[model samples]
Target: MKTIAINGSPRKGWNTHILVEEALKGAASKGSDTELVNLYDLNFKGCISCFECKRRGGKSFGRCAAGDDLKPVLDRIHTCDALIIGSPIYISEVTAAVRALFERLTFQYITYSKDRKTFFTRRVPTALIYTMNISEPAIESMGYAEKFKFYEDRFNQIIGPAKTLVSTETWQTTDYSKYEMTMFDGEARKKRREEIFPQDKRKAFELGAGLV
Candidate 1:
């Protein structure tokens, strides 16, 4: 089996990347060859409303016609057994790169007919991971949980059975004093990173293995 993990965060060694890597490791341990993709490394845009994928009898029907770096990634996902996507919360939403990938990946398979919902041939297990500076208790109050549910519901309907893993109060920087972010205590963040992040990683690993 092949499982593909996509990292939506720009920072390679940060929380989102680390968790995605851990998930891949878990899939690897299950004897599934896995790949990790960094969305920032590619140059692409969100769906341009070309509607070529929806065209009947068209050569590019049921596929994204946009030619760019994201094309190959979408091609790989079409054949993968499982998928894992991780991103850091930016402005209370996923990063722009992740959003672009999401649109291109999901919109292609979507159909307008009432007879069929998607053109995808098979169901692929999926996971969504999110890391944020806010505490766990704040997720609902901040409407993040509602947003996450919306994404998960879409993935479930269009892709496959989906689950989510969240890491809260993420450590943003080694030296927070360098930035003007005075709202957070750097030491407390460091303590939580040391104490809680490992547990998060373990959960990510299990989540991946379960996908297999």
Candidate 2:
């Protein structure tokens, strides 16, 4: 099995990236060849709506036509056995990079014809992981759950079987005093990091292994 993971967080060793790495480890433990992609390391644009992928009998039909850094990653995903995407919540939504990837990755396979709904050749297991500073209860109150479910539903429709994993109340930094932020208690955050984050990592691992 070939599993591909996309890390949509800008910080390489932070919560989002850490969870993504854990997921990849789980995939590897299952004897799957795994690759982890850092989205921020590459420069790319969202779907430009060129319609080339939709043209009847076009060379790029059923594929994203954008020629950029993400093209190769998308090409690999087209034939991969499983997929895992991880991102941190920014401004109550997924980061800008992840949003752009969503447009490029999902929109290409979407079809307007009544005869067909997606262009993906085969069904594969997929998972979406999100790390956020908000508490678990706040997810529903803030409508984040709905937004996440929307993405999951879309992935189920167009991509394959998809699951979502959320890590909340994430520790932001090792030293909070350096920043101007005072809304959070550093000790509490640190405590959660030490106690709860490992549980999240385990869940991510299980999610990845199950995907394979």
Q: Global CA lDDT of candidate 2, please? A: 0.94
lDDT of 2 by residue, 24-135 (tens): 9999999999999999999999889998889999999989999999999999999999999999999988999999999999989989998877888799789899999999
- Per-candidate TM-score against the hidden true structure: 0.98, 0.98
Clashing pairs in 1: none
State in Å the error of residue 76, model 1: 0.5
Off by over 4 Å in 2: none
TM-score for candidate 1: 0.98
User: How many clashes (backbone N, Cα, C below 3 Å) per candidate?
Assistant: 0, 0
Tens digits of lDDT, candidate 1, 163-183: 999999999999999999999
Deviation from truth (RMSD, Å), model 1: 0.7
lDDT by candidate, in order shown: 0.95, 0.94
lDDT, candidate 1, equals: 0.95
